[model samples]
Target: MATATATARAATMARGSGAADAPALMLSGVGKRYPKFELRDVSFALPRGYIMGFIGPNGAGKSTTIKIIMNMVRKSTGAVKVLGLDHVALETEVKRHVGYLGEEPHFYEEVTPAWLGGFVGKYYPTWDARLYKATLERFGIEQSKRVKTLSKGMKVKLGLALALSHRPELLILDEPTSGLDPVIRHDVLAELMSVIQDERRSVFFSTHITQDVEKVADYVTFINDGRIVISDVKDDVLARWKRVSFPLPLRPEARSASDPAGLEAGVAEARAKVEQAMRGALGRAFAAYKIDGLTFTGITCAFSEDVAREVGHLAGTRPRVLPVSLDDILVAIVRGSEAC
Candidate 1:
């Protein structure tokens, strides 16, 4: 598999497709509501020839959003456009140019890969039998293997081969690497990177694996609790967020207090003070915090010198600021949302 830096460089090289004026996929005010869960006002776009990672924890509505975009699930409110065409109004036409790989793909259990390919190939006008066979062989998938007999990784590989054989302009993959072993996952991602080499094609990758997103995505859309937390270039997002840690001052009187009520009150007061200080300095900044014994850990987007100085003053220690990974960012976002 290509290194993350190499994948990112490839994505950057493919970023200058002529269709810069319009996005490959766009969603505006997209919403879907359920009795216990909802996707609200989700909006983002994937440019032509670039890869966008759609990231979120489980039940964060990533699949719901994809289904809405595919017109498989109706949206309560929103607009979806694919290749500049309204997805609902141009469902058939949109599907012709879009290839989708579901998290759990289903096929006729008794059918062999070859039979399945032949049946599915009829629906795609641009299906290339040679390419299909080549891809299958590359993945080491046997054409005569029955769907039920194939391992989970093999099934995913078969899905990818089928999805790519038609040479679709847009590819939408949901949890493509979820259950595969590391080697298989790397192979799958490498294939995706190769696909993005075409300046006319784009990919919308939805997965919980932050490492995968960090590896190849040019743009990232992070969602949690059915809402978009952040969306921007992967590099910018990484540069803008940070992890800040500091030592918390414990009140000696509180620590020495004999009465349980008094101790609880004192500790609560100290916590309230810390929170107030943080709020005063950050002012609704995207952040999450936790107290561990005498230490305070915070994940925030305010990594500037001014913010650092302010935090140092409040904590009576120079804050330790560290660059964060996409996985850390996701955890922080989810924790911040829960804190709210």
Candidate 2:
């Protein structure tokens, strides 16, 4: 009897034996609409073995998209597939191979981690009690402690352990590191990285923390106003969105003095006459095609490639280049959100 129990446990906790072939997730033209907001035509895919970072502002429809993919919410249009199964028609089937963590994870009011983990373990066909036990110990979660008694960081750690113990092929996490302390967050990230070492596994996470994304993401998708602004290799996006700055040689007021009392009249005339011309020129100069489908809120003289070229046109010299970071891109997106 002892030998039989040991054999069964070994079989149950076996790793890397499932998920030989399949794209972890697939989304095509997915969208959801609410009374006040809509998740516009959003689409992306996560192949097995690659980590995709979902990045957006606070209300840029990141949560809505994840909910749709998880089949927790209905999408007005588009298709989603998880582990080679349709998210809607095959909801149960798809759920079998996906593990998810919400931004704010809530547990049963009175249950303890050990009990809760065992409770959730029953739903999955391939739950590994040993893995769950190991993870809890690694994260320093006191399994006997009640759910309500755990701190915010401890809750997140427990959530991750639950998600991983199922041995799912795909993991989808929404703001998993949002409010955790640095020490705990580092532990969570480190464990997640280890879990994805198998090339058959993948992760899709949405976060506002660029540093975290940079650390583990192989691909990045930038969403703004419920639409995808840029989805490409992380390096390519960084290279394309640049910042440039140059000193203003002289103030405009100094040049204004060269004119007469009618100088104001001339300036107003220049403004009126060149408004359309300026727009037309800008449209052509910055590969206008990129902005065609995108609605812009505002385009200022950013220390960017666009601004560098403009400064060059004005001063007949190349402007100094300023390094642009992901924060800079996100800030620009926020400043321009209204137009989109």
Candidate 3:
């Protein structure tokens, strides 16, 4: 069972003004080495009072990165900071204000929710009995029942209750809704959104569910093959990375003297021509492309001013532009085999 333990309990939990000034979370060139898999050069930041979706496919180092942040797994290289404090050197102080909910929370089978709260509360000075009681009621958890008797969803709610009882300044969640039903999943996401309303807290949410992230996250950080892919504000990422479709170039057999340069169509040349036009429009934002008959499509990571300016020039042959979902961008970048 991998768990992130919060090492802090303050006699009085007061929000620190200085801490809020820095990023809620930061990772610099973090790396971990194993027999065959290496999580290399992972880096990104989550600003205060915002939710950052840490996204990636399985075996893509998402868990590894989260573990490094929690200090549950030692890193071979790099630095990690939570709430502006060094995660390692000031671990106890840092954790005192940090909350964590793993994919599956663990507890003693014999313990009741009330008992668990009393036990966990003793470790944190900021633990609020009233808040815990209220949260349990809100979540509809029976405090008298043994944790083992609760459904997976109920257990998740209990975990959240404990995490929020102290009103930690930061929440680090690793697939918190992995095995949950839709209703429970929705409840969890709603709680996360509510948590940051204080503006004194932030969330680092790790899950493969792009929809959840798309629905709640303010920023997005994508990872794959043990490396950082893209990390930016959610809106910017969506706007800049787009799916572009345009008419195919004229076939070589049908080309006339008036045809535009490289517009003679063939599988290879059509791709080349689209790639050329897109690159001209988006510069290095042009990522990967594909072609089939009269249809040509490409993905540009940076939707730019030039795309609008250049649209008129290729009006007759202009490709249709459409916004892509997080999944579309992820798939296109991860295993996007259509790159010319």
Best candidate per lDDT, number?
1
lDDT at position 318, candidate 1? 89
lDDT of 2 by residue, 1-340 (tens): 9999777646633543233454688788988888888888787877788888898899998898999899788899998888656788868766777889998888896999999988999999889999999989988898898989988999998999999998878899999989878888788778778868988788999999877787788888888889887777777666665444333233356336676645555445434333343355443322211111111112332225565566466434575554456666676676563321
> For residues 1-340, could you state the per-residue lDDT of candidate 3 as single tens digits?
1222221222122444225577989999999999989998888888898999999998898888888888988999999988878999988878788888876688898999999999999988788999999999999999999888999999999999999998888898989888889999999999999999989789998998899999999999988889888899999999988877777664555454355443443445655655576656343556776666667666777676676446435434555789989998888768843331
Query: Candidate 2: which stretches are off by over 4 Å?
Result: 1-22, 249-315, 337-340
Compose the digit string of candidate 1's lDDT tens values, residues 95-209.
8788899989998999999998899999988788999999999999999988999999999999999999888889999999998899999999898899989887999989999
Please give the lDDT score for candidate 1: 0.85
TM-score of each: 0.83, 0.76, 0.85
Native-referenced Cα lDDT, model 2:
0.73
- What lDDT does each candidate get? 0.85, 0.73, 0.81
Candidate 3: worst-modelled 10 consecutive residues by lDDT: 4-13
Q: Summing lDDT over every window of 10 consecutive residues in candidate 1, give the lowest-scoring window.
A: 12-21
Model 1 segments more than 4 A misplaced: 1-21, 248-276, 315-318, 337-340
| lDDT comparing candidate 3 with the true structure | 0.81
